[model samples]
Target: MGLFTDAYDLFCIPPIMRLIGRVYYGDVDDPKKRYQVPIAITSAMVAIALLGAVIGQLVFGHLGDRMGRRRVLAWCGNWRDYPLSATIMSEFANRRTRGGFIAAVFSMQGFGILASSTVTMAICAIFDAASHSSYEKTPKDADWAWRLILLIGSIPAGLTFYWRMKMPETARYTALVEHNVLQAVNDVRNVLDLPLRNEELPPYPSPLDYPFFSRAFFRRHGRDLFSSAISWFLVDVVFYSTTLVLSQLNDQYLPKKENMNAYQDAYNVARFQALLAICSTIPGYFATVLFIDHIGRVKIQIMGFFFMAIALFAMGIPYFSYWYDHSDRGFLFLYGFTFFFSNFGPNTTTFIVPAELFPARFRSTCHGISGAFGKIGAIVGSIGFYWASQQNEENDHSNAKRITAGLVILGGACIVGVIMTRLFTHETMGRSLDDNENDHVA
Candidate 1:
């Protein structure tokens, strides 16, 4: 649910930005500027949440390590709990099925993205019908539509707060990190409904307490940490840039803004994004759930990045002119595949890896650090792509060339991700978290 709200809140902004422009900035005298939010304002609005996310991931992530995952989560009292969720799920899951379990937790993000598009479409349709407005004229309710979409996003977060507070700490954290063996056994027994035992147990061994950033810590985890952080950073650069620019890309299929009202334009963009979520994003997540454990994280990530690069380059290079001039269908097909490989590949694996790759003591902190880097990438991608698109329009450059350039950069990022995964990361599949971390210590 945290992930669901995160996706909805983040992805819903682009569609509403159009409505916002129409409602507030619609009266500009300059034809190019009319009904468009200024580039500065647009980029700031899109990047602000992601900027906040970087702070939240770092602060909360460290808190989770220090205070305990469940306690910190209750205090967080909001969405954007990716590190906590991944850590808890990874700790609780058995080695054989850990990948699938963590992937399932992250898969809620796909539903959240779908819901954003679907809800926006529904809201636009309802307003259009209620106002009895013609598609040819701007709707007076554009402001209300965008505001309502944002308000609805808060619902899921509110609904999940109590549940987050109620969640028990993971047994691994309770036992290995906290050295509370009896409580850990009780927590697991209660969860699994196993019969209670009256027998006393010996105390568990204390976990190795390596200080973060110390020499021993670096010797054990520096390479994995670098790989996780860099992989997440590169993937998010491509992932977010593609997602945020999708509305603009839909302009090719949409009629001129002058020819249609704000509501109609919002509805069409929402519909197209919803279709992409359904056909590509949602399935991609589930595909990872099914194959991640079997194929292993390292292999799946490599395959995902490789194919994402292929799909992106197909639309960006040698064939850029052909895709742009000839077939909208072909362009969309490649676009859909980029999203598919993202969820099936690095997006899911990056989240899962940090949770298992580190010791229990630093799991949340490491995951948070990796996730914060990913958000930094998101900020760079959103601002950079928006600026590029605005420059193309302002300078009378071809939109196709602007888009192709961005795609080429993203494809290159994915190619680099492939190489980094091969060199720096290792397979976590079929290995217990303790075994994986202990091997590094040894």
Candidate 2:
């Protein structure tokens, strides 16, 4: 499932991002009054995607809590391999280097994208040529090209459903829910590759030991959920804002057309920027994978947010001044700073923490909620960036301080997240999925 999903996800993002430039910003030739609307609407669509995730989370979480983790994991596994795979893979894989694992898996995705991007780029080239023609024709080529790409990519996904529906419920889930001591004993013995010396381990608890939420039960979960969601809300707002804004910043500084004197120049600069991003993600994933067990989830979160606060505060001063001075080189330094703190700190942890703190029963739903709030943040950041950029684009003197203001606000939110992390979030590193079966279930 991870392999399949990563394949789709790794490729989907570059195209989606490329499309954002095309759909919302349009060609750089026809730049709009505000670039914020498209960013906001697309972010809103992301939020909408989480709505389905929320429903799935709630339904599946309850089923998992009532039935067991294995069943939910099985469902999650297959779903991740099929229709829902791409997004899930992207979300998860932004964390670590699974050796050549992600690289190898995403090759199929990359190949698919290579073919599609080629066709699309070809259509784009034709459109560019046609636009320059004396007849001044309107080109609809790229739209159809994108549609065909979507259709072709979706075929493999649609075909995989046949295999998924026939897959069995995970053995762990069956053991707990069926409440059959003998079968449960056999499963544990087989999976662990150990003989079951004790026979009484299986029937230790009744199947009715689930549905673990009532008024008191849900209140506790709600506190954790809301805290988790709010922290993510804060993180996403600043993270996405900073990222999307950096993209605009890059274009402004790099000026693709101006720098296009040679083909290698264009490719080299883009590759250098990509290298920065790839470098940033490495330490963040390593920290999570290595120290998450010893250093603890909340501590890492606190440290990450702290890193952002310091980074943002220092960044704002030069950020405002450099743009005013039109110092492209100086702005490049600030952009690098933004990219580093983003992937190394809040960006990675926001996704990781929710998965860790929430119990398996409610983990998916909480994740959905967190993801939803994150989308809301994206919307605000999107719209806000447009407004700020438009202000900067128009009245050069004051050059709306809104972008600078967003950084400070994000810093503040990180402080809140720190507090919330200390209060409600738990350390789940190295804990097995079945460990939660004994959690406060008198």
Which candidate achieves the best lDDT against the true structure? 1
Per-residue lDDT for 117 in model 1?
A: 92
Model 1 Cα lDDT, one tens digit per residue, 1-442: 8889888887787778778888888889998888878989878876888888888889898888888888887657333477888998998899999999999999999999899999999998888788776754557878889999999998988888878878899877888777788888898877778876635333444577669979988888898889999999999998988888755765777677887788877887778888889999999999999999999999999999999999989888844467666646878888899999999999999999999998888889989999999989988887898787667565433766877788888899999999999999988999988885566554
Each prediction's RMSD over C-alphas, in Å, is 2.0, 6.9
Where is the poorest 10-residue window by lDDT in model 1?
Answer: 197-206
Instruction: Name the lDDT value of residue 100 in candidate 2.
Output: 20
- Distance from true location, Cα of 245 in model 2, Å: 3.7
lDDT of candidates 1 onward, in order = 0.85, 0.49
What overall lDDT, based on C-alpha atoms, would model 1 receive against the true structure?
0.85
- Model 2: lDDT equals 0.49
Structural similarity to truth (TM-score) of each candidate: 0.95, 0.67
